[model samples]
Target chain A: MNCRVCKKKAVTAIPRHNTAFCADCFDRYLMDQVRKTIKEFRMFEPDDRILLAVSGGKDSLALWDILTRLELDVLGYHLDLGISEYSRESTEKTRIFAEKRGYRLIVEEIESEAGATLPVIAESTKRPPCSACGLSKRHLFNRAARQYDRQVLATGHNLDDEASRLLGNILHWQDGYLEKQLPALPAEGGLIRKVKPLNRLTEKEMATYAYLNGIDYVIRECPMSADAKQIFYKKILNDIEKESPGTKQFFYFGFLDRSQKMFPYSPEASPPSEKCRMCHQPCYTDICSFCRLRMKLSPFPDPEQFNGTHPDVISLHTED
Target chain B: MPESKEQNPDETESVQENEPRRRAPTPIKVFNAQTGDHLEVPFQKRVSSLLLELGIDSETVLVIQKDSLLLPGDSIDPRFEVEIRPVISGGSGR
Candidate 1:
């Protein structure tokens, strides 16, 4: 097949777009797609530094490469979940990429700081592994943004992830989650502004981009995510996508375009936030979830003893 | 020499070997990166057919030959080494 843009020998085919592109053209097309997504969502300004939450996977690394190519001020924030060899390999990959490109990176190890690995914490707390992982990431990413004085926190969530999440939410009729499902979530009540610049791209496209551009990423999925419901949803969506090309995009973007307006997001619409007495972070309850988890693990006699004294929060950006 | 009604042993073996070579193709080695499964797939005209034979949806995984992404319609050589990497991933992203 011929390249859609330059008519060169095409190497990759984008079935959803009904087009093919050679290596060089694919790179340009990917960058253009990310650029359009960023601009379309008003994700951030030229000067606003982007703190990318990189998982060392293809999606995150690919986004980091694209954003750097677009010449945006971007910093990488990596959280080591300490899931045995998986965490070790992924952290090493992220470190190597950052050092090779002369990009600044912050690495935080959950086990080292929190005294337990993610799985251990999840097991001890009887919470789902992904839930624990996600909560910790959300708290830390927001904290990292504020600590580094960055305005925006960007995640490498692509079309598949968003679409799958939307499907799950819709299946459960989670109106609150549906309301918060936007590419760009405004910072509210001490939360950092969050954005997903890769929301328009698919995982396969990101993998291909990484492959062609020589961006090395961890190829393995999270070891603890074998039973994650999100994966099940993604599989169902992929099956549907196989039957109907562009169904995932249409369902997700269509929501973003039309249905999203039905559930407008307002800062005041959410539950009121109060400063956690333990960590001083904003949470709906008296103590934030992270602090609550830490309290559960450590069994502090008085919450006041640890007021404004979370070591992980202060030392998150340090090298291991 | 009663021109033996039987073929020479060497000639008979040569014909027997050439018959299978003409009928059967060298299977393509497909490595699944996700599962670390190596499979020998029979030759198919297009990449899509090979994936279908493997029961993999074209949208779910990538079929790569020598670092080049093969479209579903692209013809694949049975002698070429191909890798099937599943693109679906579950992570902490919500």
Candidate 2:
């Protein structure tokens, strides 16, 4: 097939958009999409320094490439969960990519910072692996942004990630999570502003872009997420999307347009009234979840004896 | 190699003389990037049909042939090697 714009040879097809593009056109199209998404959501100012949470995956790497191409002031941040060889390889890929592109990168190892890896934390606390990891990553990402003086934190979450997450939240009637499913979340409380530039792009598109742009990334999934519910939701959504080309986009973008406003999430309704005694971070209780987790890992007294709250609800953040 | 007990020289010669000689089409070698499995399948028709035969959803993966993305309606040449890369990712970033 010929390119939709240049009338040359096409390299990829976006079925949902009903158009195909050559390599040069697709790259331009992706950059334009990122710029449009940023402008539409008012994600950040051009002068604002951004800290990107990259996992050495196609989405984040592609986003980094686009942002750099756009000449935005962006630095890459990677959190090593210390998942044995996986963490090592992931870190290597991120570092290599950054070095090759002359992009500054910061690597934080969870084991060194928290006195334990993600697997250890998950096992000791009996929390779900993903939950523990997510909470830790969120805290660290925010902390890193603050430490580095960056105003915005960008992640590699694509259309499939958000759509599947929305499906899971809707399936379980997790109303609280619905409000948090936007392309941009303003910096509130101690949380750094989070933005997903690739939210409008699909995983296939991201992968294709990475391939065409020669961006090397880790192709394997996290070993801990073998049977994650997120994967199942994605599969179900893909089945629906195959039958209806634009259903995934409609379901997610439609929520942002109309349904999201119906279920408003007001952070002020129950803000972090108190600060954690340990880390001085904003939290509802004396100690934050990250501090509580560290306390559990340490030889100190049990945190439960003081806060009277269970370990599962250690964090002030509520996850679906 | 042992010869088949049911083999008949006269019958084989007669069948060979009557049937037209036609070479079988080469099968496309597909590599599943997610599972790291190698498989071969006939081109059949388009990318969509090929994915259907492999029991993979077209939405979840991009079919790559000679480093180019193939559309569902794009016909793949059997001589080319194809790679099926799954785009679905989950859990926390490692």
Candidate 3:
């Protein structure tokens, strides 16, 4: 088999795309898609300081690699949610990747910053592990971007994530979440502008790019992710995608194209995002979920609540 | 190894140094995400053929070697050891 572009021996085949590519061609192919997506959406200016929310995963790492290779002003921001060895290993991976590439990396440890581990909060807090972690990540990513004076925040959220999230939101009839699913969420109310460059790619492609490029990433799924309802939605989308190759893409991008006209998700229609009364971060409600969860956990006062008691590592780093 | 060569002297004579002999189908060690065990299969086998042999669906599992994902049409190569992760069905970036 030969690469469709360069006629070199092909390294892999993407049947859905009707093409095969050698390692070199595949790199070019991946970069082309990212560049095109950025241009189509006018994601960021060349001078924009882009802060990447890297979880030591293939998707985020691949985004960083492409953005850096494109010579854009990009920095890596990692949040360690204190999931024991997984969090430590992920933080180390992020550090190594950034240091090796001569890029600046900022690490925000949840234990040090918020004085609590994710496992501890999951036990004492109102929200589940995944929900708490998601809230923490969002708040910290935005805070880190602001602290570093970055203009944009980029995430590794890919097509499968977006499509599955959309499916899950629709299934639950979550209008607010559906509105927030847009590829680019402009900066407002203490939140930095956020973008999903990987939304143009999928998990498989990101993994291939990371592998071929010799990127060291954490591949194990989070222990807590086994119970996430989002995974069920992903499974459904994956099933549908098998019967129909392009269904996920059409469903996601088509929504991006037509969502506004069908459903008004403008700032006016939705409740205006306001600063969290406690933490001064953007939240729909008066008190942010993270702040409320923290207030609940404050009574326990024991950082080692879930340690050693649960032999099994209950975590949420699924599919990084 | 010596006993095999002695038993098949003619076979040894047939193989020339300049012309490399065709090797048997390459063996692939797969970590079955379902059974959580390592199973070996032929790398030359097509995706559909291997899934059929393993009694798994194409949608339920992903075949990856050194992180290079192989779709349904792509065949595995023996140069790399592959891992078959669970229902994390993977695909094109878009």
Candidate 4:
């Protein structure tokens, strides 16, 4: 079939748009989508240093590629969750990608820095793998951004990811997560702004861009994580998307576009956040989740003795 | 004569002796992980061609046939159910 742009032989088709394009056109289309999303959401200025949270996965790598191509000030930050082979490979891929591009990547080790790895934390607490893993990564990445003095913390959360998360939140009626679900979550207090520029593109689209651009990313699945809720939601969405193309986009982008204005209900009236006494980051209780978790996992003679030693306060949580 | 009787084929144009009158579309099964679609693309085609039929880009998905990733230029054997999983699917996204 002929390409929709140049009428040359088509390389790919976006069935939702009923459009197909050759390699050059497809690349342009993908980058343009990212650019448009960033601009519309006002995620960050070109001058702003975006601390990208990379996991050696296609989504983050693709985000890095597009941001770099746009000549935006972007840096890579990867946390080694110490999941053995998985962490090793992921960190290596992230490092190599940034090195090849001459971009700086800050690596954080969970064990060496936090006194515990994700598996260790999971085993210790009754929290599931995702709960502990998500909590640590969010806090670490936030701290990484603050330490580096970056203005924005960018993540490679794409359309399918957002939609699936939204589905899960809706299914469970998690208004708090739903309220914060958007392309950009405003920076409040000490927390830096969190932006997801690839939210407009699908997981499929991101992978396509990564493959065509020859970005090296980890193809193997993570060794220590399971999201049964997310899996179920994604499957349900996938089934819907199969019948109705662009359902994922409509579900996610629709929420971002019209959620606040449509439903003016303030669902996130939990309580005024007080800064954690130890780290001075905003938290509901006396200590933040990170500080609390750190205290629980710290090996010091007294957890209070190492209060200032555990780095800075942090925040930001995604369903998956 | 016997020769005329033998030569008296159907009024249609003469066809190759070994050739079938038509090439029916081969039925090949496909499973797309992104959309959770189980599809029967009724045709024998290359990976690239099947992608075109499915309205998916060759770069968008990794074609797996019997646990082996298929290349864009590879032909799909109808007997094998090809699993077309999106290359950039959800992972342990922290």
Best by TM-score: 1
**Candidate 4 Cα outliers beyond 4 Å, as residue runs:** A262-272, A299-305, A308-320, B1-44, B48-60, B64-92
Q: What TM-score results for chain B in every one of the models? A: 0.70, 0.70, 0.57, 0.67
**lDDT string, candidate 1, A1-320, tens digits:** 88989998888787789898998988888888898998899998769998999999999898888888888899999999988998998999999999999999999987755557998899999989999999888878887898898999999999999999999999999988888889998887888889999999998889988888788888878889999899999999888877788899999999999765688757656743787766677788877898777666666334344654545443554534
- Superposed on all Cα atoms, the candidates' RMSDs to the truth, in angstroms, are 6.7, 8.1, 10.4, 7.4
Q: Per-residue alpha-carbon lDDT of model 1 for B1-94, expressed as tens digits?
A: 6777989999999988777555577778899988788888777889989988999877778788877788888989777789998888995582
Model 3 per-residue lDDT tens digits across residues B10-60: 665666555665877667777864345877876556666777777765654
Docking quality (DockQ) of candidate 1: 0.47
For candidate 1, what TM-score does chain B get against the true chain B?
Answer: 0.70
TM-score of each: 0.88, 0.86, 0.80, 0.79
lDDT of 2 by residue, A1-320 (tens): 78899998888888899899999999889888888999999998768999999899899988999888888899999999989988898899999999998999999998866678988988988988898898888777887898999999999999999998999999998877786778898887777788998889998889989988898888878888998999888888888877888999999999999755677666654456776765556677777787777767764434453353433544534563
The 10 consecutive residues of candidate 3 chain A with the worst lDDT sum are A307-316
| Displacement of the residue A3 alpha carbon in candidate 4, Å | 1.4
Error of model 2, residue A42, in angstroms: 0.3
**In every candidate, what fraction of the native interface contacts is reproduced?**
0.59, 0.62, 0.06, 0.16
DockQ for model 3?
A: 0.10
Q: Can you write out model 4's per-residue Cα lDDT over B1-94, one digit (the tens) per residue?
A: 4555554465334555656848676689888754567878768578878888888755446776875546566678888899876653443355
Per-residue lDDT tens digits of candidate 3, residues A26-101? 8888898998888887889768999998888778888899898888998888888788987888899999999998
Q: For candidate 2 chain A, which ten residues in a row score worst on lDDT? A: A305-314
Interface RMSD of each: 1.7, 1.8, 6.4, 5.9
